[model samples]
Target: MSRWILVGVLWLAGASAAFAIDQEIAFSDPSMNTRYLSLIREIRCPKCLNESIADSDAPVAADLRREVRRLMGDGKSDDDIKDFLSARYGDFVLYRPRVSETTWALWAGPFVFLVIGGIVFWRIVRSRLGQPLDDEESAA
Candidate 1:
């Protein structure tokens, strides 16, 4: 019975330890915590599609969270931190890449495709509504 009690206490401690945030990021400033959270929400987890770094439990995401905190500690503005990470990684690291020449296709490709699809649909409908041309009509 004593051994079981000891095991229970150890289990509770271990469970709490697992949920604790990284010690290095115990910010005294509440604003810093808020800033970090906001920045993490905007950063994409490279290993997880459609998941922000804040929501991802992957190791890479954890490292990125720490790095963002470190950069915040260094007094980097949000844009500066984003630019730094974007430089190290790529635009894919950003949840929303900035609009620029390189990303013109990324920004406009979907709309262009939609327009093209609409034109094709219109042509198909028009063709289907027209009378079918028989060989006699063609000869005329």
Candidate 2:
């Protein structure tokens, strides 16, 4: 009976805590609220590395959320908000970084790597299986 009661208390505490987190800050305008949600999901948390501000529970994520809300309240345009964050934290803060001189490497690096890998893989497969092995390879 004691164990059961403790389990019940734990369950309730977990439920309440989950609800307490990620409470949306109310906005006077519906459009602003929509922008707020989008901004949080679009912005990366420096502490969490790959996770968005919306998905991160880090203290820095919380601060970023507050800053987004404050900027929206000030009637800043979405581009303005993005530019401000980009300037302060660098392009790493944006989920889809703008294609600029500095960010070209990030956007193109993956496709370049993929093409190089594919070429290497093709060469390896061709050499190994494209035809019967040469006499020297067969001997080895």
User: What is each predicted model's overall lDDT from 0 to 1?
Assistant: 0.79, 0.80
RMSD of each: 11.4, 8.6
Weakest ten-residue segment in model 1 by summed lDDT: 17-26
Off by over 4 Å in 1: 1-26, 105-140
Output the TM-score of candidate 2: 0.60
Candidate that scores best on TM-score: 2
lDDT of 1 by residue, 1-140 (tens): 99999977865454343244443443557567656766888999888968888778888988888888888889999999999888987989998898988998999999999999999999999987787778897899
- List runs of model 2 lying over 4 Å from the truth: 1-21, 108-140
TM-score of each: 0.58, 0.60
Q: How many residue pairs clash in each candidate at the backbone level?
A: 0, 0
Candidate 2 has which clashing residue pairs, if any?
A: none
Per-residue error (Å), model 2, residue 97 = 0.6
Best by lDDT: 2
